[model samples]
Target: MSDGTLRLLLPRFLRRFPADLAAIVLLVLATGVATLAPVISETPLRVVLGLVFALFAPGYAFIAALFPERGPAFDGASASATADEDERSGSNLVERDESADAHTGLTERADPRRAGSIDGIERVALSFGLSIAITPLIGLVLNFTPFGIRLVPIVLSIGGFTLLASAVAALRRQALPVEERFEVPYRAWVGAARAELFEPETRLDAVLNVVLVVSLLLAVSSVGYAVMVPKSGESFSEFYLLTENESGALVADDYPQNFTVGQSQPLTIGIGNHEHEQAEYSVVAELQRVSIRNNSTTVRERQELDRFSRTVPANESANWTHDVTPSMTGERLRLVYLLYRGSPPAEPTIENAYRETHLWVNVSS
Candidate 1:
């Protein structure tokens, strides 16, 4: 686009101007990504991104709401000429409102300058506080629903709300005269900061700039180090179990409280390889009486119930069906699934166990 065309599109020197339709398309895509990326990626990542969106999205939406019309901020020198030209053209809706207000005895509201300019550090602080306030209120509302502040629901709700606000912002901006809309002043800020950051007026200012840069670099490096470095010898493997109902739905709660001496209860067992390498696993399912006292557990009278083996690839998972039928009945008995590396150990202890999980099961006649 020509510089003149671009200048007219974005009235403010701070806002960046893009082709009209393209800007809209980009906003839509960004909103979609912010909302739906969690579905494609991991749940943890989705939650993190959702939190980020919650923090910033509300402020943006609030800013847009503040200036639904967003009339350009006018300077004294050029405004009178533009005003007279608008008067001559008979095209200023805002001007007509002033005339109507005079007849109706209602005060006319002028459009916000620089199209609802939120350009200063103080405005930023206010917006951030407002966003923090808005986010929890929304979460409070969602807490009442079945979604219960989950990643997908929160992301979609906030993302959709932000999208609506953005559309309204875009519509208002588009409705404005070419010389009255805001631009995304990226290039302007880049040039200004680069040129001005080091060129301080005094020695103290120069020292302050250097200190700020150093502090920023230190913060960034700390975060980088945290992300890139592993915790000292930290390694883990994930193992889990799930029980299924007759309808093949996973049963997360209300497990059967009573089982007959010879009746079978089926469950699915999964092992995840997160130890950073492939490993063959020998698993044992045992029935035992477990006693816990003073933050310690003691297993006694343990009976071997079942045995199985599997090879799992690194950073992957393997799951299978296992059936348990009580050979003996007892009160507050335990069903333990013990995992060991390679060959089965002579016995399974928590120390030798790569991973283990158990259920507090009861058997009755």
Candidate 2:
């Protein structure tokens, strides 16, 4: 092409090239950011980065398309008039020479900016669609694994950012000239997508809507499962007492009421659960003596109960007996019972579920 024709076309070509290049570059960068989302985010930072990339990259791409340089294409006479005017006004000849050079490519070919603008729009649309699809799948995977719960916040943050960025970019693009603005087609595509993928007449509030619905469903299901499942095999409300006497009673004063008595009394403790689910439990039992020497006080004496360490099934109970003896006289005896709704204690120790009952007897002073 002649120098004059080249100068005329150069401004438009230079303006269009950056827009096309930026669109392609932005899409590539956005994809890379998404791919690294899982790796980079130990917490919400991953989502933040993803969102930043997702919004800004495409937006800048659209901006690049919209702001292409448009230079004035002066005709021969106007160009000469400008030079003559510059000379008369004492402006340097350099200005005339540069203007002449600037108009060199006026007639080289038809504008290629149109094709660049169209390509930029298509590129942005494709990037947006791909991101929307991939992000949800990422969320789903994170939800199922042990690490899934942690990813929830990240997903939410990224999703929010994505929506905001897209909206802002679309608005900015809309303000540009029709040929320069890629956002119009993008918004149209988003509208069509909403109709095709979401409920009719419902607002297509992108990430927020999807995240809220999914989170609510998951929370409800979790609560339902917890309520429907029986928590323990051993019933927390019922306990059994089997005294050395066939009548389930221990004579408080038959032997020494304190440690002095060598005789051991056999007693059994049991717990039952009516629910159909098996439950693991921690069981506790204590033997206490009531005294009235100065005032009434209860003393819990250590007793050997061997059967408190196992899980009981639904409608089932474990019964075991231990021999307990009193060390002093005049002490009124009692047995305490406790049934736990969780795992059995790792070692024998006192727990909180015990119930207490007394057995009275006459003691010789």
Best model number under lDDT: 1
Which model scores highest in TM-score?
Answer: 1
Q: What is candidate 2's lDDT per residue for 1-365, written digit by digit as tens?
A: 88567656767634343333434445444545544566643334434445645444444434433443221222232355555776797865466787545544543232224333334444556556655565565567667765664434544444444444544454454565643343223444587667655754555565656877799999978866654453545534456565445465543324323333556565555556565557666665545455446775645444533335556776666666656554444445554455567644444333334433334432223
Candidate 1 Cα lDDT to native: 0.67
lDDT tens digits, residue span 1-365, model 1? 88877666765632432343234335445555755764644334333444556676666555655653323323332445556775797775665887655633521223335533554443446657777887777788899987888756766666666667666666777677764565444575687687668677788888888888999999978865754563546467887888777787665555655667888888788888887778899899988887889998888678888999999976788989887887768888888888888887886766688888888888887
Each model's C-alpha lDDT?
A: 0.67, 0.49
Deviation from native of the Cα of residue 21 in model 2, angstroms: 84
TM-score per candidate, in order?
A: 0.55, 0.26
Which stretches in model 1 have alpha-carbon errors above 4 Å? 1-54, 68-119, 134-154, 176-191, 194-258, 266-283, 289-303, 307-322, 329-334, 339-346, 349-351, 354-365
**Cα error of candidate 1 at position 241, Å:** 7.1
Q: 345 in model 1: Cα distance from truth in Å? A: 2.6
lDDT minimum window of 10 residues, candidate 1:
68-77
Query: How good is model 2 by TM-score?
Result: 0.26
Cα deviation of 124, candidate 2, in Å:
74
